[model samples]
Target: MDASIGRTAREQLTGRYVLSLVAFLALVYGVTQDIETVFAITLGLAFVETISILRDTPTVDSRWVGVGLGAFITIASLAWFAWELTTAAGTGGPVWFPALTALIGVWFIFDARADFADGTDSYAPDDMDASEMMLVLNHGHLVVEELRQGPKTVPELADACDLTESRVREALDVATDDGMVYPVDGGPIDDVERYALDESKVGGVAFVRSNGKRILRRIARPFRR
Candidate 1:
């Protein structure tokens, strides 16, 4: 499966952002055009985004409540919009808008299910290949370093890495997806989630550089703090 797709995780994430933004904007434009049912649907979508902002899944507590909320909102919005679209007559607005919305809805549903199962903070259409996995795990050196010392909470990793909590979580999720990391408590993460490293998977030139980087970071951490 390593060669399933050549795209990297970062590239996948960028594409997802662009696609979601375009879908959202099209709905807005449809509203301006007074496309029937577009207004209610847009409002529902807006509410979903607002909840996501308030919950802040990327940096939220590891209890998975925020993740569940995000998934819920996603499907709910689609359901509401779908109902509206079906019940009302089309203003014959751009045929493309509804089609795009449906496509995006399908994607959202798939991803929402995934987000609930695994705390993947980033978009992952499918399992990453070996090289893609390496690339993601490599960029998260500080997280690996902290985990090697022992298990760590998101805030602890964030502090150690001098990265925003959100970015630290993203790194953890990326590593987790590749089997390079996992929660210390096993199956379900509790209120205070602490992640541990899988040393078996940590071997390679990437970790060699990462080990050197960790050593350097340890030396400079005090001053940086």
Candidate 2:
């Protein structure tokens, strides 16, 4: 009955179902010798995945990287298709063209899959609303929990949280502002900021996690109703 849990479950289910359907349709098109349909479907999926990455990632650099790579692949695919359509013989240039493009498309899909598998989407708070602020706090609390295991650089925290460095920095800012975390004394020469939880904070990681969960439940109550 927990709305947050239900919504998460539903999202997972829907993602799986949609992916499977796309795969099935692609296979059918391939089997029927409908190369155009297959290419269209592959392109559509790639475009969608690119948009999803842009929307979900919390950093400008990540967004730009995704957009750049996606645009290159899409443009390349379209160009190849155009060449095929406009050639003197009216037949495609070579088999490798479509195959290579298909491989690029598959790579994009796999990248999106990897992102989902690592739970990166959960790291970014959707908005500055009360519920979202609580989510941000929860994220910060989780970062603190990771730091309790050991001091970590921003990149390490980003890897742990499946988020971009910017997103991790955002969470750390919240924790730092709330006096839940503080910077470590020394770190590597790369100028990466290292963070550790403030042991002086009342109840430490346990308290933050517990309270954050309670707040999240309260926020999800209206959705359940």
Give the winner by lDDT.
2
lDDT of each: 0.62, 0.65
Candidate 1 global CA lDDT score: 0.62
The worst-scoring run of ten residues by lDDT in candidate 1 lies at 1-10
Off by over 4 Å in 1: 1-139, 186-191, 205-225
Clash pairs, candidate 1, are: none
Listed per candidate, the RMSD to the true structure in angstroms reads 18.5, 19.1
TM-scores for all candidates: the values are 0.30, 0.33
Candidate 1 residue lDDT tens string, 1-225: 123222332333467785886697686776687554566766666565544443333344323443455465556555655655676664545555555555555444454455555655333223566786675556587789878898888888888878888878778877886578988663454568789888887878666766677677644432342
- The total number of steric clashes, by the backbone 3 Å criterion, in model 2 comes to 0
In the range 1-225, model 2's lDDT, one tens digit per residue, is 245434544554487777896788768786978887787777777665544544444443342354356456766776677667677654646757765775565455444444455544322335687777887777776787888887899988989988788778889887776567888755466565678876767485766875788677644432342
* Collision count for each candidate, in order: 0, 0
